[model samples]
Target: MMLSEKYLQIRKHSEQICEPLEREDYVVQPIVDVSPPKWHLGHTTWFFETFILEAFLPGYQVYNPAYNYVFNSYYETIGNRVIRTDRGNLSRPGVKEIYQYRAYVDAAMLDLLKAPISPKAEELLLLGFHHEQQHQELLLTDIKYILGHNPLFPVYSTTAFKLHHDQTKEREMISIKAGIYEIGYSGTDFCFDNELGRHKVYLPEFSISSNLVTNAEYLEFINSGGYKNFTYWHAEGWDWININQISSPMYWHLIDGVWHTYTLAGLQPLAVQEALTHISYYEAYAYASWAKLRLPTEFEWEVAAKSFDWGQRWEWTESAYLPYPGFSKAAGAIGEYNGKFMVNQKVLRGASLATPEMHSRITYRNFFHPQLRWQFTGIRLAK
Candidate 1:
């Protein structure tokens, strides 16, 4: 496929995910990490304008100059912008305006892709698509978060990603032999900068669960007072639990002795056999402790991933989000992407159902703050 076609397809899918959303759903940011769906649309457009069209195309005009302040995320090298917590408060660039912004930028991007470009410009263009794909996943997740937390329990779309009950496979652990292994992306294909600089690491032999922790399994933890018992939680996790009064996973509700949670398909009975998702690192870690198991490090996960089925959920790892030994950031605003966020985050491996096709690879490292539970985060036991 041509580069222009790939770019259009990806950009179109981002819009499709929002098709089911009501006009009002596009402007909400329920938490600090989640950008409003409208913001995602605008910011992704801004990324192309800022990085590709404006940088690569001669005489490219930005659709809106003030949009820089509204859409600029944490890239301090770019310019000053809105702090995250106030995203929901911005109402000027309504949903309609954001869509126009997307159209405007999309035209310029396609025009740029029509002509041959330098290798470095092409690299940035590919990075822009992947970056949008990352936000596409975030778009779905943030949409879920916006709706799931509502008192109405509004369903975003019945067709959105959800699990069907599967009782055919028995849960088992896959044992991996200890060995030194190469980790990180080595291919010429597009990968985020963090995934570059492939290196070697030694992993002790460990057994990883063949399947993710199930809803029924997590139910056991809840019934056993998992949230109440400080022994099962880390010190900071314990504080988080107490302070937030969290008794179950983010969307869970116990209604008249029945377990149900809000989903893209709406509030429904929790599927016991389905993998438990929408969990945080703290919850995953605490549940691991409760089960007397451990979460695999990212390296260990890559080493054993082929032996079992994954990609249903973003499995949290027991690793911190850090760079490889020889990793270095590029010299400009693009350089600020992943390297800056290395400090205070936990890594998740595998891909979620919302993850776009070709967007994830085994070596891809996804990181989030420990307290966030809005994404499709799950656990795979290792010991």
Candidate 2:
């Protein structure tokens, strides 16, 4: 696809995800981790304007000078902006204004793409495409969180969104022979800087499940008092469980002695056979402990990924979110993307149903603070 076409398609999809939402829904940030839908739309637009149009397109006027303060997210080098927790507090720009901002920047971006561009501009354009795609996934998940938390338990869409369910596949462990393995991105395609720095690592023989853990399987742990048992949890995880009174996965409810889960399609009976999701790294680790197994490290996951079906959920790995042997940050604001976030997070391999088309690769290293359960996260066992 042409660069301009790809840009338009991705930009459009972000809006389509919000079609079912009410104006009120676009302004909420329910938690510090979940940015309001309006913020995502504007932030993504600001990325193109700041990085591409401002840098590459001469004579282009920024849509709003104040928008940079409103939309800039976590690029310390980009100057001061709104702190994350306060995103929902602003109501001035509003949803309609944000949409207009998107349209304004989209025009300039397409115009820039029409002409022959330098390699640096092309690189930032691709980065913008993928960056928006990343927020596209977040847009859906954040929408889910916004609606799912409401007392109404409203349905975002009946048919517009659906998660992949893995149930019929028989559970089995796929054995991987122990050997030294090359890990990290080795392809010519676009990948985040974190996936760079290809290196080798030695691994002992191990076995990983061919399928993800299912709702029914997880129920066994919960019924056995998995959440109540600190033996299965790490010290910090145990502390988190007690401090937050966390009992089940996010969006899960036990009603009238039966389990139900909130989905984009609305609240529905828990499908025991479906692959479990919305789990945290802590929950994954505890569940693996209860099952007398362990989660795969990211390297083990990459080496064994081809042997099994993945991408149903973001599978939690035992690996910490660390840089590779030769990892280095790119200079400037772009460099701040992944390198700064290497600490106190766990790596999640594979992709989730919420992930955008062509957005994920096996070498993709997704990290989140271990306690977050808002995303479509799951687990696969290794031993």
| Best by the TM-score measure | 2
Worst 10 residues of 2 by lDDT: 161-170
Question: Which digits, one per residue and each the tens of the lDDT, describe model 1 over residues 1-383?
Answer: 98989889999999999999998888888778788999999888999999888889999999989989999998989999999999899997988888888888888888887888889888988888899999999998888888888899987777655544343488788988888899999898888889888888888878998888889999999999999899989899999999998999988988998999888888998888888998989999999999999999999999999998889889999999999988999998988999999988999999988898999899889999999888888989999
How far out, in Å, is residue 89 in model 2?
A: 0.4
Clashing pairs for model 1 are none
Once fitted onto the true fold, the runs of candidate 2 whose alpha carbons sit more than 4 angstroms away are none
Off by over 4 Å in 1: 160-167
Per-structure clash totals for the candidates: 0, 1
For residue 382, model 2's alpha carbon misses the true position, in angstroms, by: 0.2
Overall local distance difference test of candidate 1: 0.89
TM-score for all predictions?
0.97, 0.99
Root-mean-square deviation of every model: 1.3, 0.7
Residue 66 in candidate 1 has what lDDT?
A: 92
